[model samples]
Target: MKFPISWFIGLRYTRAKRKNHFISFIAIFSMLGIALGVMVLITVLSVMNGFERELRERILGTVPHVIVGERAQGVTDWKSLEQQVLQAPDVVAASPYIDSTAMFKSSYAGTEYGILQGILPEKETKVSVIEDYMISGSLNELVEGEYGVILGAAMARNLGLWRGDKVTVLVVEGSTVSPAGISPRYRRFTIQGIFETKSELDSRVAMIHIADAAKLLRKGDKVSALRIRVHDVLNAYMTSNYLRANLGEDFWVSDWNRSQGPLFRAIQMEKTMMFVLLTLIIAVAAFNIVSTMVMVVTDKQADIAILRTLGASPSTILKIFVVQGSINGVVGTIVGVISGVALATNLPAIVKFFEEKFGVSVVPGDVYFIGFLPSELNAVDVTVITAVALLMSVLATLYPAWRGSRTRPAEALKYE
Candidate 1:
């Protein structure tokens, strides 16, 4: 099989040993640099993607995807409204809840302020995963009229309280007016359960039976909101909008986007900035090919003159050098992608191994939401990185290849 003249010569040039070892060094360096840059970018992006996924599962899992509430007062017709919400597109389950702010004080520890939520244990499971993280007792222990409370692990720790312990809860929202000014409503409740999400919420949230919450708030058969879980959490915002439009202005529809959107958006922005910054490393490495090719053209002046004299067109000369330079990009990109994917996929295991070997924790569970490193390789990320690298390599070759093609045959021969 005969190869094209330009391809054959170009390949020959790539494999040939050059007299100037400096040019050879630069070529090798550029290839390695590109490989390193690509690998790092892939691994970092994968880790970021992993963090995003973890946040969604760990934090968002226990939070409502969407909440439907009355604009004024509480949701008096929540049972019927919940049925209506269930009929909405993408709605998987709906549970009635009462949200209130309160301060909890324990006899053994200090007072802590947190969000106190009221929920029906059975119905709560349909919308949130609170029951899954229980450290002690059960959500079912929160019986109506018992005024039972569920404390977050961190909050429980800070309050030095445990299951079956008594905690005093003070609510300013439902305070009563008295002769000695407004008196804050308060209740003493026994802890029924404790849960840990390993997140900030663990220190900022508490829960009780909806019936108990209703009585404390002086609300009869009314809930603060209808918590809705959707089939796809990513579509929660859209679902909220649909519910808002259908449920009318009298009802307020909110989603995770309102409460947690900023955090995720910040993560995304950081990822983008990191991508742009790291891409510069690859760009610098890719541009190194320009210097490598330039030196190659200079060293091959006599060869170029000879080829031109032998009826090789300037365009053919350009193609030869372009192909030679492109070989470095292709090889580098392939190596980088393979290594990066491998590293990203096994990152968690690798971190675990090192942590075990060193007798140290890279991600502490109590300090961070997760106890181990995580990674999630994305095909789109790999593809984009590959394309960018190849493009940069090809572009870098243009100037040098064009200069080589413009060499004068007569002048080159004279010097040779």
Candidate 2:
């Protein structure tokens, strides 16, 4: 049950109340600072993680992970191309699609431009979660030749259209040569469904049956591309490159990175910046430990001289101070981690409570992709924060401890 002499004395010194209340106050302040820094870092990082997850699951989930297409002309043999796409590594599902920009005009809502996409309901379900977000009607209602269309919720609201309402689609790809200097091809489509993604896409995307899109565009049986969903969205860029290499130069393979890379990259950069900025809080707290330790060393000078007289070495005095300073860091880090995790796990509820109490929305659906603040605690984030705090704490003790160790036994006791 015997402890090392240095450790025993260090523990005793830490437990004893300081005669100088100011020194005690500094020590307590240092401990609290470390705890606050760690807690804020953990909670903020968790919230960022949640936003990234939502981007992948909610926003990207509605779009294809990868697209395989012919460089010249549409994919005439889309069925075969779909099969090839499915054979590629990481490919989970493949569906043929015809994507084009078109103007949609409704009698009640006027006109708006958006991406018009053609899809087979059954196959589309495998590549995207559009079916899950349907607010009314269903993708199955998009019968071939029926010219039925699905509109985004915002688009539908703006157009003042509902199920069975008619909208005219105008495309410039298949204009006819008339005496009136070529006319744009157009078609009337009945609204079959409406979906709400709560994303930017909700205002600028529309869908219809593949056959109808092909006919409207005069592409015959050909499709613009084969949409591929991968097992992991994070690796879509690599998977797309692999497909491109294997599919040859005649075909082009693209992934979500082509369209959404900038957005996600911006998010990642923000996360990195936040991590760097927040770490300064912990660094500042660690500095406070230095000042606190310095004061302690000054107060304990006579004690150090007495211990040295009793055969304690300089190294022993150093170890004693290091142990004492480290205790503050250890206790603070433990408290911070516990509270941070608790706060992070319940962040959504806390946000909701505040919103309800104040009658103000923290995240509005119109302004953001999601309507509520989200949080996802990561173990790696917690571990890294803990390691940084502890390292800083231990490092902060070094200079003060070294100074304490250098105390002259004769000089220190001469004053007493």
Candidate 3:
């Protein structure tokens, strides 16, 4: 195939052995730097994306998207409120829940503090992923009036409690007045099940039948709140507001954003900061391209002079160097993209392999909310990274190419 003279000569120059070997080394180094930068940036971004996805699907799935309750008292008429909430736009499911802070005392492990949630097993399935994460027993085993509790995996382990074991739950409320003073109410509950979500919730939360919780809290036939799930989780804030307006002034609505928004925001901020920091690596590589082109321009002055004598225009001279520098950018970017995507796609396996090999955990579930590394490569992110790299490459070439183009045939040849 035929090629433009500038392109052909530029490529030939790239392949040619240089008198100054250091220039060739710098050229190679620049390409490798760009490749490494792109690869790392893509992999890190993919991991961040994975974390965000897990948070939305796993953690958010367990927590209510929107919760409605009476501002002054518990929702005594939750069944009626549930029906109303289900009618709201974007709302998909609603379940009555009772919540309280309690201390669980195990015969073997002393005591632990936790947030207890009362849920209707049948209705709970419509709103959360708790059933899917059950490791010991079924949610159906939590019979009404049985005083059975489902403990989170971490919480259970910490308390040395297992299914069928009995634990004492002490609630600070519902004190009994006596001659001496008031006494907190307490109840003994059998452990019916255990669940693991690999999230912080697993260490700080427990569940029981809503009916049992109501009795324990002394709020007969009432619940603390109504948990609602929506079809579009991103629109939960708007849905909460809609519930507040439609449900009247007596009820208050709260969404996941109010309770968990800061954590998600911090993750996003870290991702942005990481991208900015990694881009500097690519910038430094682009600078190397500039330096390489400057040296090339100096070395090829005799050739530029010869070409000008043979009727080559300054524009042609500029095109030659631009094409040469851009080749480094394009090749490096392609390699980086291929390697990055490959690594991101198999990151989980890679992490597992290293973990098994070293006998150590990279992402401990108790600490990081997940036991393993996650990755999800986004096409838009890859495209943006590639475009930025190419732009920097082109920009780096301009100055050296302009300087080369201004070489006068008479002056450049006189020294030779």
Candidate 4:
């Protein structure tokens, strides 16, 4: 029976010849290396993607989306500005703010430095995301009441204060400068309730009534800034631009992207850099593919001479070796894609399982944000990684495939 081109020759080329055990082992190692490299890259990238997502949802969602404020001076006619800003596209709400840094003495007589954010709770939902983040107590309580305070969970722990506790703010509101340098002003406040954001902000920030904060901070009716929340996060920048264009020269609007710009950019750069460096591991494995194919070409020379004499073209010989090399490449690529996707898809559960059983930590929360390896499998990422690995594998086969095709029937059959 006349055999098919692939069956008659290609199958024979890929088979593990009994005499070249070392070549077979090299092929196995190359495939394994590719599989491992692809798996690790996919897993790590997914974790980074997960981190980015968490930052946006948990961190940004808990923070203000935009801040509209004056330059070094202060906002004029804020209610008017609020109306104008609200007219911008995607602007959901606007809240006036009186934010300051001061030292607060707890009930235990121990004091610590922190941020005091004075906001009108009634209007807060218009501008800040904080209202939705209320784990306890009403924002109305923080607004209508005098000297009421809301403390972050971590800040409450550090200061040793609780609801209904009185804490005094020792403001260095620049001295009543005598003949001396300065004398600090003191402001007293009552802790209203504790709030948790589960972010770094929770450890150093406190919230209070804008009216009360103005009274205590000696700012009168003047709010330091205008906090604005948008309906869509992606349109934040465009809305900010609209506000900036209309809100006069003294006022400026900044969106979440501009506010968190540097931090996110750093993450993106670091992830890209690390991924590039890790790809060298795949390159090393491709070199193994080269080594294996070279050895295969040497071991299969006599078979090459027989084929050449039987009218197989040099290109046909090349295809035979190419197919042989690509089998290792294709097999490794397929297995690696499967393994990587599987590991990425189930990474969180797998880590949890191991943690429960062995009490071992794959990631730590204090060191890394919300610890335990988080994996978010992106299909595009998998495709890109697999394509790159296959490219490297194909490149590695060139020299050996060419060498196999160029083998002379005379010399190769002389010792047959």
Q: TM-score for all predictions?
A: 0.97, 0.96, 0.92, 0.88
Give a tens-digit lDDT track for model 4, residues 1-416.
Answer: 88756445766767646586888888999999998889889988998998888777767776678889988556756898788888888878888888888888876848878888888777875555566666667677875447778888777788887777788877665336788867777766777777665687778888888777776667866778788888887677788888888878887778788668788889999889878987888889999999998988898889899989999889888888777788888889889889989999998998899998998887787566567777788888888899999999889888998999999999998987
Cα error of candidate 3 at position 101, Å: 1.9
Each prediction's Cα RMSD?
A: 1.4, 1.6, 2.4, 3.2
Which 10 consecutive positions of candidate 4 have the poorest summed lDDT?
4-13
TM-score leader: 1
lDDT of 1 by residue, 253-347 (tens): 89999889999999999999999999998899888999999999999999999999999999999999999999998888888888999999999
Off by over 4 Å in 1: none
Model 3 lDDT per residue over 1-416, tens place: 88899999899888889999999999999999899889999999999999999877888998889989998778888888888888999999999988899998998999999898889999999999989899999888888889999999999999998999999999876668899887878999999999998887888898999888888888898788888999998789999888888899999899999988998999889998999999999999999999999999999999999999999999999999999998898888889899999999999999999999999999987687678999999999999999998998889999999999999999999978
- Output the worst ten-in-a-row residue range by lDDT, candidate 1: 365-374
Pick by TM-score: 1 or 4, better one: 1
State residue 350's C-alpha deviation in candidate 4, in Å. 1.1
Q: Per-residue error at 312 for model 3, in Å?
A: 4.4
Per-candidate clash tally = 0, 0, 0, 3
Ranking by TM-score: 1, 2, 3, 4
